[model samples]
Target: MKRVIARCLIMVVTLLLISGCNTIRGAGEDIERGGEAIQRSAGG
Candidate 1:
């Protein structure tokens, strides 16, 4: 029973980490696009 519970906990943590990574990556892309827009507007 203990082993089953441990496995489930690990799986949940792993999923959460993976989701967090994707969220960070998406945010980075959004910020990069915003920066590019600013640069274009500034004629730089």
Candidate 2:
């Protein structure tokens, strides 16, 4: 029983970490696009 609980807890934590990484990656892409737009507008 303890082993089962530990396995479940580890799985949940791994999923959360993966989701967090994806979220951060998406945010970085958005920021990059915004920066590109600003550069284009400024003719830089």
Candidate 3:
């Protein structure tokens, strides 16, 4: 489960990096939103 989550996060980060965040703060927010989505999907 941990590995799966880690992989998902890595994929999200990679995709976001490729997508162009424009700034570190924007990237962080994007990542946080992505994480929240993941948590919600996981029923957290």
| lDDT (0 to 1) per candidate | 0.87, 0.87, 0.92
For residues 1-44, write the lDDT of model 3, one tens digit per residue: 99999999999999878678888898899899999999999999
The estimated TM-scores of all candidates read 0.50, 0.50, 0.54
Which RMSD does model 1 reach against the true structure? 9.3
What lDDT does candidate 1 reach at residue 20?
Answer: 55
Winner of 1 and 3 under TM-score = 3
- Candidate 1 has its poorest 10 consecutive residues by lDDT at 16-25
Kindly list the per-residue Cα lDDT of model 1 for residues 1-44, writing each as its tens digit. 99999999999999986775588778688779889999999999
Best-performing candidate as measured by TM-score: 3
lDDT of 2 by residue, 1-31 (tens): 9999999999999998677558877868877
lDDT of 3 at 3: 100
Off by over 4 Å in 1: 23-44
Q: What TM-score would you give candidate 3 relative to the actual structure? A: 0.54
In model 2, the Cα lDDT at residue 8 comes to 100
